[model samples]
Every structure is written in structure tokens, then in C-alpha cells.
Target: MATSSRSASTPGWPVSGAQSRPPAAQGAGGWTWALTAPLLVFLAIAFLGPVLLMLARAVSDAELPSAWPQTAQLLRDWDGNGPPDDRLAAALGTEILAARRAGTLNRVANRLNYDLVGSRSLVYATGDALERGASVRGFADLARIDRRWINPAVWTAMRHAAGPRTSFYLLASVDRRLDGDGRIVQVEREQAVFVDILLRTFLISAVVALLCALLGYPVAYLLATLPSRWANPLLILVLLPFWTSALVRTTAWVVLLQTHGVLNEALIGMGLIETPLALIYNRLGVYIAMTHVLLPFLVLPLYGVMKGISAAEMRAATSLGAGPLTVFLRIYLPQTLPGLLAGMIIVFTLALGYYITPALVGGGADQMVSGSIAFYTNQSLNWGMAAALSLLLLVPLTLMLFAGRYLTKSVPV
Candidate 1:
């Protein structure tokens, strides 16, 4: 009894042995890890695994090496200067013939075509010539098979591709490529579309996020300040869109924003305009649809934060001779900023990757990076390009998320 009293009085001291729990009870504490183990394993396999695979696909360059092993090895040593040597030319010809017989020449050709257009036919024609007994002892003989075989650009592309990894996909995604001298250069203005697409993606996402904040702040404030009877119904209305499919909502916007649609007809009946506005199939429609869809995301989080703020604080400020605008700007706005930042980040990141609404409602000028990613994945089957574009999209979002997290932590509630 004396030892137990001492154990209870002395902090950080071990309990008396007589008072300690059984060994079985002590072991039960380990169940915490056991309970969480399944979640850790699931996240590793489902999320981390695919993210690593995407990173690998963006940089892996195995097509040429897999299809033309010997030639790829030889080309790796070549400086990618003027032209290939006699031995390198002969090896390339031999490997092309071997790959043709093995039915893998198409893979090498298709990979090369990614670097230089028309390279597929160039590779196929040369393979056919070599198969037809066109002896290739040097660059001259290979050139006879196909004149493009002598072009430094083709050889440079081949040398660039002779790798266990390459930056071609990542570079191409940003409208850049290696020149014959192995220096990075901008692609021709005509071919430089990805940069524009990427900029347009960010611009559209920023606009949508801004619109959501502007439209959602008052709605969320009302939801927080109104009486419970009114607030409950209003919140349900805000959440109603979540129950419907995003695709269905987007399609409904299309119907409402079209030239002869309800909005235009209503305006016309009130003599608002002489002709139907070009609202649909443009940037305006993209803003309208995305803002409507993402407004709840902003409102819900902001409303949650706003509800936590004390009405007494605002009243105290007002009693101290503060005006309504002064009370809000100096007292309330700072408290709600973290929630606003969270909602804006959520809406912005979602808008960054938006594909369907923009594709459906906006014209050709409004296609985002996701459209290009989808085109590469489904149509062109260029997994590298798709993965590279995905990384470009992920990088900015990750930076913004980190910044928002820092701001939320630093700002006083």
C-alpha cells in the first residue's frame, strides 16, 4: 500500500509491480499497429505503386533497345554527329533485317516515328531493301536503301533513343526537343501546342476557382448566419448537386446555355438583346458550368469554418465602433481565410484536370491538358507522352498544395 501511494504520487515513475497489469494486457497495446497495417499495405499497393509506374513510364525508353539490341548498343557509342560509321551502318542494317524476321521491326520503327515523322516508312523501306539482298557494308549502301538513312536528323533521333532511359517524352510534352547537336531547342511555332494548352489549362482553372470564391463566400456566409430553419434547407440545396452525376450536370448546362436555350429565351422575352448570345461553345460556358459544379466544394468548407467563428467576436468589434465592412475585413475575413484557401485549392486542382465539360461546352480553343493526355492514351497509344503530361499537371498542383498547407498553418484562426 505504501509503494502504490508512492507510484501514484511520483510522475514518470514506473508503477509498483503489484499494481501493474498482467503481461497479456500489456501486449494488447500492440494491436494499434495491427489495426493500421491493412490500411498501410492497401495504400502502398493501390496508390504508391501506380504513381511509381507512371513516373517510370514517363522516363523509360526501351522500345529501340528491345527491338534492335545490337544496333542500339552500337548507336549509343556514336556521337550523333554527321553520320554513322561503316561498322555502325552494317550493324544497324543487320539488326533491322533480324528485327524484321522476328516481327519486332514495327516497334522500333514506331518508336523512331515519335521522334521524326515518316521514320516508320523509312525504317520499313530500309528493312525491305536489306531483306531483298541489298548488301549494307557502309553508310553509302544504307543510303541507297533509303536516302533518309543518311540524314543526320534520323541518326540523331536514333542515338537519342539508344538508352535505358530518355527525356524525349518529357521534353516533347513541353514543346521542346533535342537538335542534331544534342542541344535542347524549341519546336517550330506550328508544332508548339502543348505549352499553349498547359497555359490555357492553368488560366481556366484559376478563373473557375476565382468565380467559385466570389459566388460561394456570400452563400456560405448566409448558410452560417441564417436561422437553423433556413440554413438547413439552404445547405441541402447546396449539396443537391453532389447527388447528381457530374456528366448529367454538364449536359444540362449545355442545354441551358445553347443559343435557343432557356437562358437566352428568357433574356429575349425581356428584350435584353437583339440576338442570342454566343455563350455556349466558348470560354464563357466553361466558366459558367465549372463554377456551378464546384461552388458547393467552396461553400461547404467555408461554411464549416464560418460556423465555428463566434458571433460574439463580430458583435464585440461592432460595439467598439467598427463598421460592418470593418468588422468583416478586419475581424471575420482573416478567420475564414484558411477555409477559403482550402476550398479554392480543391476547386482549382479539380478544374486543372477537367476534360469532359470543356470538351463538350467549349470550342476547339479551350481543350485542356487532360484532353491531350486522353488523346495520347486512347488514340495514339503513347503512354510515355500521357505520363509526362500527367507529371507536368501534378507538379504545379503539388506545389500549390504545399503552399496552401503552409499558409493554413501560419494563419491565425
Candidate 2:
């Protein structure tokens, strides 16, 4: 009984051996590994594996010019300043004839067409003539089939196509490309669209995150400070959005905000305005829709943090002669900042990749980075450019996430 009393009173002591449990790592090593393997495999197969593949595809060219040993060697030696010489052209013709006869002309054309616009039809036209036993003594027949065959730009594109991998897409994503002299140079100002779109993406996402912060702060404070019984109903209302489909919610907003929609009719009926407001299908619509959807992200985090703050601390500050503004700025705001930062980073990163909402609500000029990514991947069928754009957005988002995580840990609240 003395030993039992001592064991019961002793700090960190097990009452009895029968009541003991080993440290999980020490006792369940095999079980831990066995249970964790499926998750690791799932992550590898679904996320990490696809990310690595996208990274590789961003730099890889679909063309396999080297597969034609003689043609590749001939073109590699030719200066891309002007059109190829008759000998190199003859080699290209022979290879095209062989490729056409082997029923791979379409693949070859599709690859080259990515580099040069009319190359697909040019290949098909020339291959058709060659298959029909048309004479090709020089570049004359090839040029007649397609005027691009004699163009310097076509030679430049074809010269670069002689490799399995190239940085053409990555360079182009930044509005730079190789010149005839094989030097990296900026594309013309008229051709520089991605850079402006990228900047606009950052601007729009930042604005959306700021809007969420400003709006979510008040809602979260109310939820945290109110009596739990009172707040529960409002909290249910706030969470009602999640129960509905995101697409359905966005579509409803579109119907409500359109020119002849419910909002305008109500305003006009109430003598609020004579003219209908331009709200849907523009930057305004994007901001409103995204803010509504993502506001919960900011609110939930801020509410969690605010609930942890003691009312006694604020009362103590008041008793010590601090004004409401002073106590809030110094005490309350500082405590909630970690959660604010977390919520902003989450909303901003999500906004950077926003596609469906913007696509459905925003006009052409208001689309975000993911819109361009979808355009390139689905519409243009340019995987390299799409992957490059995706990487461009992901790198900065990852940096912000890590920096915010470090800040969150450092903040006391």
C-alpha cells in the first residue's frame, strides 16, 4: 500500500505495469510503416508523380528530329540564317517521303506544326506529292508546295526542332525566344502578353485576398464574441454556403447580378437608380464572386484564433486605462494576426489558380492565370507552355506558403 501510494503520487510514474502503454514509435514500428505505406504510395502516384512529370514536360519537345539520323545531321550543320541548302532540303524530302510511306507523317507534322504554323499542311502537301511520284530535284518542289518552306523563320523553327528537349517554352513564357543567330532575345512588344497577364494575376489575387480580410475580420469577430447560443445560428448560416455546390452558388450570383436581374429590378423599383449597373462579367464580378466563395476561408481561421483570446485580458487592459481603440490595436489585433496571415496566404494562393469562377463570371480581360493554363492545355494543346505557366504560379505560391508558415509558428497566438 505504501509502494502503491508512492507510485500514485510520483510524477510521470505508471500506476501499474498493466496500465502501461509503450511509446507508439517504439512499440508499433511495423504497424506504423504498414499503415503509412498506402498514403505514401497514393501521394507518390497522384501528386508528386504528376508534378515531376509536368516539370519534365515543360522542357521537353515533342519533336524527334534526331530519329532521322541523316536529316538531323544535315540540318544541325546548316546555318539557320536563310533557307536550307539543296542538299539538306533533299535530305529532308527523303526523310519526309520515308516518314509518309511509314504512315507517320501526321505525327511528324503535328510536332513541327507547334514550331511553325503552316508546317502541318506543308508536310501533308509535300508528302502527298512525293507519294504520288512527283519530282523533287531541289528545294523548288518543297517551296512550291508551301511558301513557308523558303522562309527564314521556318528554318529557325526547324533547326530548333532537331532535339528531344529545349527551353523554348520556358523562355517563351517570359516573352523571350531564340533568334536566327541562336541568341535569346525578347519577343516584340506586341507579342508580350504573358508577362502582363502574370502581373494582372498577382494583382487580382492580392485584391481578392484583401477583400476577404476586410470582410471576414468583422464576421469572425462577431462569431467569436457573441454568446455561443446566439452565434450558433449565425454560424450555421455562414456554413450553409458549403452545403450548396460552388458552381451553383456562382451561377446564382450571376443571375442575381446581371443587367436585367433581380438586383437591378429591385433597385429600380425602390427608386434607387435610373440606370442598370454593370456588375456581372467583369473585374467587379470576379472580385464579388471570389470574395463570397473564399470569405469562409478567412473567417474560419480568424474565428478559431479569436475564440482562444480571453475576454478577461481585454477587460484587464480596460481596467488599466487603455481605450477601446488602443486595446484593440495593441492587444486584440496582434493576437489575431497569425491567423490573418494564414488565411490571407491560403486565399491568395487559391485565387492565383482560380479558373472556373473567373471563367464563368469574368470577361476576357479579367481572367486569371489558370484561365491561360486551361487555354493552352485544352484549347491550344500546348502542354509545354501550360506546364511552364503552372510552374511560374506554383513557385511563388509555395514560397509565400512557407514564409507564412514560419511567421505563423513565430507568432504567439
**Scored by CA lDDT, what does every candidate get?**
0.91, 0.84
- Write out the backbone clash pairs for model 1: none
RMSD of 1: 3.5
Best of the candidates, lDDT? 1
TM-score of 1: 0.92
Per-residue lDDT for 297 in model 2? 85
User: Can you tell me which runs of candidate 2 are displaced by over 4 Å?
Assistant: 1-33, 66-87, 101-103, 135-147
Predicted model with the maximum TM-score = 1
What tens digits encode model 2's per-residue C-alpha lDDT throughout 41-149? 9999999999889878778765546345577677778766556778878888888888888777776677677666787888888888888887566788778766767
